[model samples]
Target: MTPIFPAKAGHSVRILQLCRAIKALGHELTFIHVASKLDTQKPDIASHVAFFGERHFLHLDNGPRQARFAFWLRGKLRRRWRKILRGFGHDHSHYSGLDENWRNPWSHQLRAMDRRFDTVVVEYAFNSRALDAFPASTRKLLDTHDAFADRHRPFVARGFRKGYWVSLTPQDENQGLRRADAVIAIQAQEAEHFREQLAQYEVSERNPEIAVVSHYIGLDQPLPDHGVDHAALYLGTNMLSNQISLRQFLEHVLPRVVSSIPDFRLRLAGSICNWAPDIPNVEKLGFVDDLRAAFARSPLSVNPTIAGTGINIKLLDAMGAGVPTISTVTGVRGLGGEFNNGLLVVADHDHAAFADHIIRLSKDAGLRRSLGLAAFADAQRWNERQLAALDHCLRGDALTDTAPGHVARWRDRTPPPFPTAT
Candidate 1:
């Protein structure tokens, strides 16, 4: 169950992929979406689910009324309260109960369903409170897309004041994680983090089991004939990390590339275009209907992300489409450090060097073809791994803690030449 409206956010994409994976394992699947107040019932939602073939989709009229009301009320308090706190040069984080709306109606809905399924999979940790609604007979699984605490750490370290209403406490996060029967971690780093956290909570018996399921493009490989299209593409939802990355690219990298290539075109696609800055040589294509065709039109995908959590769906999608990707080391975090594939990694803050690599890839079709083919091959392998991992989780097998070895493998790889020696 996901606490979101239908959109192409990375988490939303994961929910859809998990649904398909569940069905592929020959299990009956039902998707219960907790509609946000901003989300009206989307007729296209049913059509979208139909694309996955057969699955039952249930959209609650809207999220729990009380929680939404509280969310609104607390939002007002945080806005006013923070100003007074800032006057003293102090930061006091308030935890709002409003954020987790799965208390009454959502819980009731699950109880009404009456443990009909073998397991209940909750998409985000914020929504884990809903796990309490399921019967003892039902296996509760939590998909920790990213460790919420780790996600907030970067923001807090820079003294960036978080929106208080949605602020999460370490205890609050651990409570939800500890309650789960099992956890599906998006990356190996997070899988290890979850294990260490579980030990801190000393959760025994019902201790949350951990499984690492990295993101993957479906089994379909890209056709080699699509050929390089001479443009750089960026795909993202309207999240803060994406906004910051896009802004950085525009400010630091795009100008340099434009000076050299003259007609260099950068296409920013998805809901992210809504907030991305206006800049020269960049076309903002908001919420594209055909992402594959978008990739076909732009052979080079750029991920300039400096801070974000979980496996980047855009990275996987571009590689899956056999488009060569150039990104900062932070952009490629959680993904294994394998530069032999079609991925180019640059240092976090190198603007000129990043531009040079962009120029190199843009000009060399053969290099693009080689890297793209390698990426496609890597994606195919990941598809199999994701499916097998999902199958093990569903079959109730004990998941080995793969994080230590996974992290070791990544650390063991000789660091790729940042801004490849051009």
Candidate 2:
């Protein structure tokens, strides 16, 4: 359970949910958050989940290993020392997704502590160090939240090769699949895509024991009234995809919207440094403490995303707050909805046309409110409870009787092949 991303990112959030759900199922849970320093901005989120069970931090020594005489040999000694250390390297705090380089510290430790657990639930494929460390007896499993290799397409498309991200693609991903006891895809389409593409990436065609698991949300209690904010808002915490989407939006559409509507302010929030577009209507709100509050303040949430994987969490948070949304098809792909009727899904990729639609929604309060209500209701189904099966799977509590559906679908699905981490 080494959190590869910062504690607040979607991966960490899902990990916390899986662990807690597993704990509730009468199994023990442990979280190994590796790091030299914890991202202190949000200790409470981690703290809330801490009450359930074990939390450990394995920090490796930071002293330099390279000397002037044998700089080239430094890598050799470092590799040996890495083996000696065997668990938990420096905390990769800013990594939004998994990278297969720098032997992850936990894989080795978990491999050594093999006796403690019967199965290894690898949340991401970056930690091959763990794959090697995995006990011979313990089973391995992967939850393909995103096509790990797809994220690296940018580097590949750029003609660059033999870098950290390049190695993570296909190789480590396939290794994870081949070695794992099972592979769980977040969406059905994605599961099919994984099966079809693994072979293209030089992975086995007889895909691993694949299963489709929906993204988890905390689908508990009657949603409270999300008081309204009339402004149109966009929020992102420095994800590159978000930046690309924002750039597209500003470059193509904001001028028309600002000119047409006097009060229309397209507020941009989150970790965009020096990214204030010169467009008249676009206002940068910066990152907020609780984005839910920002959603509460804005009646309309915009999802101009072009590329990203997994459920857009910001969309769900907005839906949870009962905020009406206008998102591109890709952005709205996995969010809960009925026949595409739940949210104001806009297919017009053009920013001006999309902004025109936004302007129209802004004028009509009834249409805006309806979209929010329906979206909130739809979000109820995908909440945290849905991940119970995933939790059970991770704990090796997924024997047939307990999860016959899972067994029928997954137990028979042959083990998948994933690439070896470089």
Candidate 3:
């Protein structure tokens, strides 16, 4: 089950694409999800769920009397608990800084709808607890969006809390994956990591089955006009990691680019615009309904992500839209053989170099056109390869090339398209 409706978020896009692909391959699909109480914006849930033959939304019981009494009892108990913990010189922080009832609070409802499907795919590590509510006969699949233990490093390093960090510890990820009959990681690196982790728990030669299925956008040909807009698009939600990346882009990269290329502009789209800095020439277009129109207006896309795990689908989306992209190393991980190729440019987290690349590309119309076309081609190839891997994994194929080190078997040795091509 997903934590929210398929808004413009990366995880949401990945799930919808996978569901559509699964359905297109002649398998029935259904979605089991919980709503995010804090987000009032309603995404097009009907259109997304239309691919699936069935849908179920699990809701929590919250009568007024029950809510008031629960709040009162929680406050009373929290005060007493804090007092006792303080007496022992321990920090009694807020109880589980996660969404309320994140641990399968609606499992009773989920359990009732369990037997209808032969296989259940639970998305996100936090919602893995829902897997436990399913019957033993049901084949459970865990779609881990990222390696959370690694993803939480930035938060942990910022002194978030031991309790919070512990919640995403490696053991916690292991617990979630261990429960699944099969596991799907978004990146190849993470998929390998899961196999190693599961090996420790399994006595046999094979442990929990695992596969790498990257996000597939299946975008059509390049945007028509590559000459009109000199804007660099930054599209993403207000995820903590995205906010950090956008802040860095504003503070470090945007100024240098604008200085070198006076005509350059930056457009921030998606929910992250809520907290983004209002800088000169940087327009914040929050929650745009048509992302392709935004991409069409911008020739270049930049991802200055400082800290995050898993593949950045935003970067891939830019590539899919047939636009030239520049990203830091952290933003381009798990892109086998795509890094530093002609598909996109890469800068070593250096703002000056990033700005220079932006300036260089801004001046060369031919380079931009060629790179965008090449990116479109690469996206098509990667989409095919990833789909094949997904089909293989779903068919219960035993893990191949299970040797220790990082496997590069999926890499395409074909060279990127020529930049001089029309």
Candidate 4:
């Protein structure tokens, strides 16, 4: 069960990719979408039907009216309590939206289903409550897109008033984790964090097994170089973190790049363009229908992320398309360092060096082609490894050599040799 639809957002991409992978593994799928109260956009039901088949696709609206009214009444009371707490200088950081009571209405619906499921995979820890609807013998897995314990701290430290997505206290998050038979963390560091938190909280007699299953992208053959000279692409949604990173890149790095190569052009795509500043040589291609075509038009991609958790799917998408990429160290977090042959990592806040890499790649078509080839090769190998790991995760098998501390086994290996020809 998931709250998000299959869309272009990073998390949504991860969901769709996993679903496809599961189907490819020959297992039938039943998709349950529990719509969030804050979600205003309607999902394209036709696309969902095409992907999951109409019979298997289930979209649950915001429950019955009585349940909705109860939830609303509770929310009002909580707000009143929050206001009272604020006057006394107390902070309440728990996210009530994750409360299992919010999903109570659907429990009966899920229980009423005539079919039996061997395994039930819930998308987020907050939605893990859905697992309770199944028999105790059925396997339950929780796919945590990111760590949520004190999730708001990072955004708050970055000067934002609140976190972009969900935030919950350690105790609250631990409650969700205890319900899963195995927990799927998107990255290694987060896997370790979950283990530590579960141990610390002693939430259950046995903590759920934690598995590291990073994002996967299908590898594409390198397109013949038809890139615009001195042009780079930055594709992202208008999330607050994306806004901050792109704004900083424009303010600090773009000027130096333009000064060195006056013809330099930056292509901004997706909702990010809505907030993009009007600037010279910056072309805004809003809501690109064909991302592969967009990647083909640019010789390289840039992920200037200075803050955020989990792997950056945009970076992975660029690598999958065989485009040479430059990213801040934080941007490449949770990704294997072996892929560095195709990805250039710069220290955060080092604007001059970031610009230097951009300038260098813009001027060297041969180097760009070489790196893009390496990227495509790396993406192929990475996809295989992730698919194997995900298969193990779905089968409830203990992943060998993938323990949190043993990340070096996969992440620190020497990169495979780049293909001599593509």
Top candidate on TM-score is: 4
> How do the candidates rank by lDDT, highest first?
4, 1, 3, 2
- lDDT: which candidate is best? 4
How do all models score by TM-score?
Answer: 0.84, 0.72, 0.80, 0.91
> Which 10 consecutive residues of model 2 have the lowest summed lDDT?
413-422
lDDT of 1: 0.70
Clashes of each: 0, 26, 0, 0
Model 3 per-residue lDDT tens digits across residues 1-422: 34334446776677767765665445666665565433344655565445443344334433357654775577578668867775675543323222233533366667665347777887766667777888888878878877765444456576643322223445566777777788888887998888776665433543567777778664666766678545788888777778777777888888888777777788888888887877687888888867778887777888887766788887888777788788887888888765334344455468887888887776777887888888777776676656556655555554345232322233333222211111
Report the Cα lDDT for residue 122, model 3: 76
Residue 213 error for model 4, in Å?
Answer: 1.1
**Residue-by-residue lDDT tens digits, candidate 4, 287-368:** 8767778977787899999977888888888888888899999999888677667988899899999999999998888888
Pitting candidate 1 against candidate 2, the one with the higher TM-score is 1
Every model: Cα RMSD to truth: 6.6, 9.0, 6.0, 4.4
Model 2 accuracy (lDDT, Cα): 0.56
**lDDT tens digits, residue span 245-354, model 2:** 77777777666676778777777766653455555666776756556555555667888887667777667666666667788888876543442344666664767668
Please rank every candidate by TM-score, starting with the best: 4, 1, 3, 2
- Estimate the lDDT of model 3: 0.66
